[model samples]
Target: MTQGAATPLPTPKERRRLRESRSLTQAQVATKVGVTRETVRSWESGRTTPRGRKAEAYARLLSQLAEPAESAEPAEPAELAESTAPVEPSGPAGTTGPTEPAEPELVGAGAPARTPARKNRRAPSPARPARRRTPRREPAPSERPGTPPEAFDALYAHCAPYLVRQTYLLTGRRALARESVERAFQLAWERWPEVAVDPDPAGWVRAAAYEYAMSPWHRLRRAHRVPEAPPADPEDRKLLDALLSLPPAYRRTLLLYDGVGLNLPETAAETEASTPAAANRVLHAREAVAEQLPGLAVPEQLHQRLTELAGSEKLDAPRSTTVRSGGEKRTRFWTRAAIAVTVLIVGATALTVRVAPTKYEPVPAPGAPISGVPPLTGPQHMTEHDRKLRQRLRAELSGGPQRLAPVAE
Candidate 1:
């Protein structure tokens, strides 16, 4: 009977708006409910209504999106009818009742044709407008007043070793690991207000390290230009070195998942990647490193060591210097220049001594030779001789002797 049929549902626009408010795309909702995007689209567009379990699921999803309706409002039959409206196209044309073709008998065959059923099945409820759920707000800046400098120092002390270990895993060099970890903390200190608020401070520091490692200037300063091949232990020093050699994104992905012990979802959140993308990054990073260092296996001991290191308090110490904008380049240039100058000075001094003529005494002034002095047998070793020799030798010698002459009798 007509009374047994399901009621019509809301127009599609309402569903779309509700989903949009929850920050879900049609595809996302469809995926959650085991339906196609087109089906969701159709539902939202009001072209059709969902039925049975599908309709129930849509209602559930909508319920999740909205806060529970206030209990203060008592449920009424008319209100119930409005709330149970068909979410999909299951009802008869323009009719607000159930989809059953024939009117069912209530109170025996003698009862009037329009009589209601046993009331066990409630009337189809209408679609109420979805309510918005307010997101929990973070503490106001005024309330937080920022973390104290002491807190930063404490955090640094706790976090430093972990950071160093992560840096080592990425760079595989102790010096670079120290440098990267130190620099990361320095930067963190400078931006403590923001960094401290991050859900995972270690993760943030690791990300910063990856950025530092990937920089062009950092690469150029590497003592070992080519990445050191991975060691037999994937968590070994060599493995860490190889990882540091990888592209920043890959390194970040791997460290977050494998090194940091973050699950796929957590890794996705930390790296700002989708679940699938994060999974792919982890897989590829592992494969890439493995390819280069085939002998190295993922060592449980190394993982434990890194985890222990990360958990230690001493590892958190903040470094004195922060990474300045364009600072790496400037520092590299000056360092290289200093090394070059030192090398040139050393080279020049060696050449001047090697190529310059040996000084000789002037026959002991033909009379009284200075006490303890051995008489010179050759040309006078006067200042003038030295000057002249230097000038002549300048062009001929090109500074230093390439090969020394043997001692003569």
Candidate 2:
């Protein structure tokens, strides 16, 4: 049958019998119908009833099949009267039943009421008392002032092994374990203001570490690096090695859920995966770890190792190469000064050449007037001999004797 298809409605007698057969009090039916117990009682006694939508909803609930009643006999008149009477009203308005008299059973006492049992099965179960639990006390404000340094320290002290395990799982390199943790802590320090306020600092660190381990920079750094030997403890080392060998996705989810003790939903949230996806990741990671380390115990030795590793070491502060040593600044200052002086000297030499004035000397072609000198007033058409003698006379006047060329052939 298709889901949500409307089913057949129940008769008033069927509804009342269903509720009673299911061991439901009148109030239960009243609550489902949004009426008082008096109303439910009225419906059962055939005096008053729900109609339209309310009636349909009542019928739907009563249509549910329930377990067969223990006794086959019809209820005694007194019991029937008591069952149909209005009980104390509970829940909201429109849920109370109307006052009414009881009706005779539709079937004889010996026949089992299959219809009632079917309807009663659908009746809602009785309300249960809500459990009360003591809330966990939060750490004092003084004890947990949110700061990058505080968070980094806490993660290093309390959550290092899990991180190491995660790093190992991702890269399968023992040496990267410490570096990954350090890098994750460094990033946390850089963004401490935001990270410290997070509800789960360790989770934040783990996620950051996972991201860092997957980054190109981390990959390049680890490529040439050799794996460090596992620790002396066989169990501890074995778990670490196994974790390191897991794929990144599986390793991250597993560490978050198993190593870090987060619930499935919490792990999903931390890992940015759906709950089902996170569950799958965890399942695969567990299987992988189990397969790799058959003799390895995940619960006992791994937890102990993680705890011990967390306490034994501290995260070192990130190093800075930005600080200048003595004489370095002085050397740079002198270099700049020398370049400035050289530029100025070269500029002055170029300017001197560019601005200096050039002296001019005049040259005249044969039979042409000397430029910038006084014009000659001799005849325009003169014999070649006269021209030569005049040129010689002019040359003599200018303090240089001129030689006349012989006539050309």
Candidate 3:
């Protein structure tokens, strides 16, 4: 049959008769047909007609209903299934049904044909009263001020997987998800009094997780990223691929709304955006998501599928193995490293401060030169010109004629 071809649905009376013949309730039949009980009622009352795949599903269920009543065995009732009482075993003993062909009766035999003897059966044990379990006592409020340990545990159980999955989708890295969730939870723990009292504690943690997931700190560890596909079912793999194609901010807005189950205002507050902006982001993201769907799906169909997909896949649990949060550890390591470097610099500078010979030479005494005039530094201490000048100056001072003397000297 063609995929789009609508299967013929049995008429109202026929459908009701088939349902009764099989001893099934409307709810049971609706579950089999993948519709609500009201839908089943509407179908039986000729109020509406099933269409497309839904019609096909109804047709398939009708075929099952056509089978003999003995062919179907509904599961045992909850009480019977969980019953621990010893069975009150009583049935026709030593009496066989005609499951096996009976041997030909002896001609004109007075005694009735004897059936095969039944197997030996054991007797039931006596019933005993169920032991009552003692109720555990709650710890005093003095031990835990506002929110108790149990409350935090309950919070963690609810939000941890949700935050992790959100981070994982955002970063496309499992380790980052764990790290983000861990950091978010740590912050929550530190401010439990406030967070516990807040209207949306999960919102607070989710915002923190989003921040951690998008942190630039992750860039330093990019080299350590091992290229691998996310753990997903086939359909989810396609969805993830589509999601990765979207811009980071848009992708985040989408997940926060659909994946994280936040409203426009909550998502906006977390994203530090206006409500309109968040809505716009969601719309854009849906458009982007729609592109990832196959050719068979129209925009409306794609949207419906996406909504269903989002609902179905909370990804509340991760893979068996995980790379837990190392952000805190890394922070501590970097802090120590910076401190060590600072210490080394300070020590080296201190050791270098000690005086060097050339740097701290003692000042020489400032006094008159040994000679009245500086001694000549050349090979001939005095030049021939100096000799003449000296002779002229002595002649003049001794009252001799100054003519033809070296007056310049």
Candidate 4:
């Protein structure tokens, strides 16, 4: 097929369909195409387009795989095909190598095509299209203009139960998990305008729930202070313990990638981390879990174990109506608190103005001693000169008076 000009590559959806129709896994395709499974995933997701020599090689490989898939009768559902397909051997972490630009993949290059088994199943005809699964329900009506409170309840009811279980894995405390899921829904309700228009509303709520559940502050809460009881089964207990033992980031990455079955890029996007960092976290988390439960060394087993543990717990979400009411109550409480604070500030200012002095009053000056004045003393201590002057005055008066008296006689 590579000898002639390569057939034009199919659309992303077609590429994925062609691969699945051949019962070929992404890892198998990646192995055959000399690229990482993530690169193949990106190609199918239409995030990036392959180019250069790799593109031609990928095209030829897909064309080869397509020949068999196109001619073969529809044997089984895609899920069943995947289930029956042989598992690829796990490789070392470095097997994927450094991340490459996203590219397409070739499926079933060396693998045998699956043959149809059921006699009752009808072969798809050219006139009639093959049966397809029903598309998932959308939240289109939930975001209509002036949507009712029930719209939020619908969104909550759809996401809350599963999210609670997911958060429980993040934080081992059941109470904290329930609270986290409820709080996340409340936030979503508060930000409905934005969340309603979001591409992935469920993801928005999930991220919020994960953040709140993994918060360090939850440790301070009395209810979350003591650890929750471990799962009854030894295997479930070990798995939960292993999950809780991982760093929050690692655990979240592992759950998103393995448990939730999100691709690496999607997991990275949800976790708000780089792809390589997210991959690293998954590796470390898997290693940690494997240490405790060697049976779960394979990712598929880990995913199954996670599902079982979550299902085993009775971590039911609160009613959506109750959550909406709680959110509304919280909003009202804060609003009233803010208004009261503003009124208090304004009233205090007005009272201060009314009681304040109308004019400035100067303070009185302090008294000080007067200088340059004689000191008061007693007259008993007269000077000798003062006595002499008084005696002379008396002598002169006595002599003059005696002469005048004789002349008159």
Number of the predicted model whose TM-score against the real structure is largest: 4
Candidate with top lDDT is 4
**Per-residue lDDT of 196-217 in model 3, one digit per residue for the tens?**
7654566667767788888777
- The TM-scores of all predictions, comma-separated, are 0.38, 0.39, 0.42, 0.57
lDDT per residue, candidate 4, 74-147, as tens digits?
A: 44343322322335545684221122212111101001122111111233558655554333445375454356
Question: Worst 10-residue stretch by lDDT in candidate 2?
Answer: 113-122
Give the residue spans of candidate 2 off by over 4 A: 1-134, 138-175, 222-224, 234-237, 296-409
Please estimate how well model 3 matches the true structure, expressed as its whole-model Cα lDDT: 0.57
Error of 2 at 256 (Å): 1.6
Q: Give a tens-digit lDDT track for model 1, residues 1-409.
A: 1111243333354355345434467799998888999998788656788888888777777655533321111122333223323343444555333333222211111111112121112322465432322334575766543546656555555556456656655555556667776676666765777776654455566667656754668666647586644345444544556665677777776665545544444455456555556656766776676676664334233244434433331323234333333345556788899999999999999999999879874665456645888878998756987899888889898866788779989
Error of 4 at 156 (Å): 1.7
Residue-wise lDDT of candidate 2 within 216-298, one digit each (tens)? 66545545365555556666666667776777678777655544444344455556555557767766776677687764333
Error of 2 at 81 (Å): 48
Q: Which regions in candidate 4 have their CA more than 4 angstroms from the true location?
A: 1-146, 358-409
Predictions ranked by lDDT, top down?
A: 4, 3, 1, 2
Q: Score residue 79 of candidate 4 by CA lDDT.
A: 35
Report model 3's TM-score to 2 decimal places: 0.42
Error of 1 at 19 (Å): 14
The better candidate by TM-score, 1 or 4, is 4
Error of 2 at 230 (Å): 2.7
